[model samples]
Target: MLANSSIDNAASQAKTMFGEELIWLFIFGDLCTFTLFFFIFGHARTNNSVLYHASQAKLNVHFGSINTLLLLSSSWFVVRAASAARKGLIQKCTRALAGAFILGAGFAVFKIIEYIDKANAGISFSTNDFFLFYYLLTGLHFIHLLTGLSLIAYFIYNFRANGITRQNHATFESGAIFWHMVDLLWIVIFPLLYLLP
Candidate 1:
């Protein structure tokens, strides 16, 4: 009975920490998808190490580094915002969300420029297997970032439009969770695509 009670309490805490079960389900499914993609990329790299390493050399590590910093900063802001929301500090939460959105936007712009630079250099989707995976992984991650940005924007707008209150704080928590998910995904993607040997 004691063991069952302890397990139930831990489960309750997890549910409370992560918010809605639906979102957790979505995150879990998305993570599984990314894991599958990671396996495929690793298998391909093992099979064609020479081509992979050569193509990786063509990628601009500078852009990747800058984007990494941006995402890390934005993720920090998201953590701040979520913490602020928990404290019922709506103003602080809004400001942090704004910071996150701006940094995330900067990441998107840099990514676009990187894509353009590659195109100008005659790199295209059909360039080779490495380039193909590069585009696919980064492009999909970019889409996820955009979605998180949109959620942040909406939360900010609703706060400003409706005036600050604790009523919708749970809603803000949901969005913040998604933003962190995107950030964590990028953390894995950065080293995998840019720094992996």
Candidate 2:
């Protein structure tokens, strides 16, 4: 009886820390997808080292670095927002979330400009295997950023109107978790796509 009770308590604690089962399922699915893509990219690079390196050289490192900083700053604001929500500081939380959203928007703008420049240079996904991965991976991450921005907007509206309190803090935390995942994905992508040559 004691062992069973202990096991049950551990499971309860895990669920509480991880959030809703559906969210965990979504996150795990995304992780698996990205992991597979990364593995394929690595294998391809290994098989075609010269082509991969030559293609990687054509990428704009400066733009990639700026976007990295933007996402990192946005993630910081999200952390602050979550902390403010926990303390019942609705105004502070709203401001932090807004900052995060703006930084995320800045990332999107920079990415669009980069894409435009690449297009002008006659680069397309079909140009090479490296370009194919570049476009597919970064484009997927961009979609994730847009989705996160929408979620942040909803949270901001909720904070302004209903206010985040201890009772509703779980919702804020869950959103933050999703935003952090977006940031984490970019961090992995930036190094692999830009700096790994």
Candidate whose lDDT is highest: 2
What 10-residue stretch in candidate 1 is worst by lDDT? 1-10
Per-residue lDDT of candidate 2, residues 1-197 (tens digit):
11344345434644668345566678889989999999999999999999999999999999999999999999999989876665567788889999999999999999999999999999999999999999999999999999999999998987787665433456566678888889988999999989995
TM-score: model 1 vs. ground truth: 0.88
lDDT of 1 by residue, 110-153 (tens): 99999999999999879999888889889999999999999989
TM-score of each: 0.88, 0.89
RMSD of each: 6.2, 6.3
- Distance from true position, residue 131, model 1, in Å? 1.3
Which pairs of residues have clashing backbones in candidate 2?
Answer: none
Stretches of candidate 1 above 4 Å error? 1-15, 164-167
